[model samples]
Target chain A: MIEVKHLTKKYGDLVAVNDLNFKVEKGHIWGLLGPNAAGKTTTMRILTGYLPATDGQATVADFDVFEQPNDVKKVIGYLPESVPLYPEMTVTEYLGFVADIKQIPKAKKREAIEKTIVTSGLRSVRGRLIKNISRGYRQRVGIAQALIHDPRILILDEPTTGLDPAQIIEIRELIKSLKGERTIILSTHILAEVTQTCDGAVIINDGFLMASGSLEELTASFAVKKAGVHIRLRSASAEASALFKNMAGVKDVRPQDGGFTIEWSPGADLRDDVTRLVVEKDMGLLEMRPLGMNIEDLYLKIISGGMPQ
Target chain B: MKNIWAVFKKETKCYFTSPVAYVVIFVFLILTGFFFHSLISWFNTQSMQMAQNPYYMQQININQMVYSPLFHNISIILLLVIPLLTMRLLAEEKKIKTDELLYTSPISVLQIILGKYLAALFVLFVMLALTGVYSLFTFAYGNPELPAILCGYLGLFLMGAAFMGVGLFFSSLTENQIVAAVLTFGSLLLFWILNWAAFSAGAFWKDTLNYLSFFQHFDDLTRGILDTSDLVYYASFAFFGLFLTHSVLQSRRWR
Candidate 1:
């Protein structure tokens, strides 16, 4: 588990991260969403003990990041944005080095390396020098090194920033597989990544918390002007409008192209009610698309200072 | 201790796996071989000429004629070569950003510094040991004072350690290897010529400059005149350089 309370970081006069707060339960994958220069990297560095925070407190696995950094370090694995590594070392050799410094006991070191190798899919290129590997493989090695120690919390800063479409899918699959074992916090500018992988999200812009919650909660936020779900029937019918309108929490309804856009009061999930109501009417439901369905719309809506008053 | 060992092992492995260790050791041995050949041949002729005069034969001192000059000449060679070994110690880490991995691991900064510094010292030890083959040849042909030659080697090691300390400091200050090398060479050259500036100073300042000069204390050990103060000087200078490196790394974190 991780909790950051009132965390602020400053580089002289520049406020990089300003008064941020969030929490992640054990076995949860949380996405940290932001644009460029949004203090994502700075925040990770502070949590990893690589850079000191200007103010506030962050704890990982119940240990304070500032007061007991070494204790914190022992339980956390960090992958920096650039994927820093020793090009001269082979994949297995690099993982071994990380294991040694992390103080993995002598007997368990080999087991840990083997487990991580299989987990990250690095067995095929274990002997190849890191500099000789492809960018995708190198990124895998970066993630491999972080997992060798098996810390309780893992922090990755833009792990898939520079990769092909196929490689991105491979890396994302690897991350999703490790979700239930530890608390994972990954930062990225890509919207689909959060919706596809994270259990929840903490969205920040200009170092301030704009909005944060589960996917459903954030999609139900006030940022969506006419907030709710839009559904399309198998066949066009006038009664389709009346069925959704009678449901509680339904505020407004409109027609868009071949579908009816249903607007609900803020913070209501009408998907279950709408789906059940459609079946009751013996109408074929062709589709249902929620407003701000993907974080792409929600991310843009809130980032543009469009948060409804 | 384990963390330091890990860093030491990694650094030493890096030195040998690349062409750096072989190239550095080869260049050092070849240069010292030429110096040893010329000094021994030169001493042979000088001794032959002095043998003809019964009174002049009393001045036949191989310690002064061969060992002293050889040790002094080796110091100059170290001044040029030590920077090559020390330049990449910290500079490369910062350049490739491996320091991030090193810092975020469960190791202290002191362990990282000590580990790297010890690797450089180990390389220096290797270079000095290879040159020891020269002293063996001298011992085989002529009876040079064993203690004096050994003392001279000790002086050379201490001087080289001091040089490495300065080199490591420069390496920590920059990410570019060339900048680190040039800065190490430039600042070390200044300290080497520091006593020359003493020639024109007032009495008190003259003594201070001479004492601050790296060569001043080294001169005593070359003659086999061992002193506690001289040993302290080199050891302390080496530690002081490493201390400066530690401060640079620590301050960067806070900033």
Candidate 2:
């Protein structure tokens, strides 16, 4: 639903987004992952047609962001980073205003606003002024405004930022529930959020595209370098560490509390071999589990230029 | 068109919800009332004294003595009050980050500028309408020339709208509403005094300064003279102000 090619945005001598390329397929939730000031918001702004790019092109729902900005805007709903809102308006009033600006027909405007109020779980606070609401409710109102038009694509910048833990969980579930219905581009620096909510992720650092792929693919690619397993045995023995180090695929073995951790060579599945050796050697095998690389590890590896081959 | 209306409705609603609209109207009514009452008392005393002399009675026309100065004073009051009405139109949007919502929407920048400008004009219209009660008082007690009064009001409305457009443009240029208001007031004050330069400057400079003074064109309207050139000047002034606002909004995309 969205394609960005060689997107470069420069401010005087500073480059905000440089040579970035990525694609988000329809009905998939993609995370634009990056740290603060990593140009994530700038990229989203360019995609939403709010800001013009210095070079390259982007298209949303088959409309070029620059050439057909109105069309692009029609198909996309954007929630800016700060959750822009009119404090004097009520939740229902604000949503109605957004519905009007989004060009929802007058006959269906009430229904659209009511539906969005229900969807964003804002019915309870629909009559309250926005300035009087809590941060969590304000965030919900922001999401409600974005969803009032029911556009095909939703672009949210840091949707869960400034929320309590409970509110964060609720919002995460809300986003996850929206997974298959629309194309979502959620930007955040939270690694766990991407792991928990996105089908694919595009990692960026210092305005450069560090990596982009499915979550599994990215984890698998990074796993090639530091793949390992942790085994907890009933008995700790120096002999077991020596025996494991001598194994063909085993690269190193480190003794830990009550057991040993093993690192293996790339493209090696030493689980079965290690299991058999542990059982046969009577080392009292208690627990054996493969350690898959999480997004934190993958992010660190990519940012530090240790990209998988 | 619908987008503009939507924005217009929201903006107009916002003006009432906040205290700005009430305070502006209240202050305006009090000032205009004080001016109207004093002018009427002075006119009554002068006319009573002139009643003794038949020659002077014909020269003391109520329209000249009352409506002309009334409308002119209202116009000057509008000059001071318009910036307050327009300062928050665009500057507050930028300060609160709501410009993202506006710019990213499907609406064109021209529509946004027109919608906001029209909303400020609407507020000015309401304020003027309330002041009409004072005009009704004049008609009730004495004979004030209806055509001159109407023409004076039309002139004030147009000039006020032109000044509002300029204030809206200044609001778009800054994120601080105070700065926007002060700059708009300062610029309007400069134009108010531009005619004074005509006395010191020679030839070309005098004509240029006189032409730039808003009150020069407005004076023609107050005298019940419907000059097409004066109408064009007010219309063009408002158009240029809105045009500059549109350009400012468009430049933000590039920035």
Report RMSD for candidate 1: 4.3
| Cα-based lDDT at residue B235, candidate 2 | 91
Candidate 1 per-residue lDDT, tens place, B17-134, comes to 9999999999989998899899999999999999999998999998989989999889999999999999999999999988988888889988998999999999999999999898
Pull out the clashing pairs in model 1.
none
- For candidate 1, state the interface root-mean-square deviation in angstroms to 1 decimal: 0.9
Model 2: how far is B249 from its true place, Å?
A: 0.8
Q: Pick the candidate with the highest DockQ.
A: 2
Interface RMSD values for all candidates: 0.9, 0.9
Scored by CA lDDT, what does every candidate get? 0.89, 0.90
Give per-residue CA lDDT, model 2, range B75-128, as digits (tens): 999999999999999999999999999888889899888888999999999998
On a 0 to 100 scale, what is the lDDT of residue B145 in model 1? Answer: 97
TM-score of each: 0.90, 0.94
Q: How does candidate 1 score on lDDT?
A: 0.89
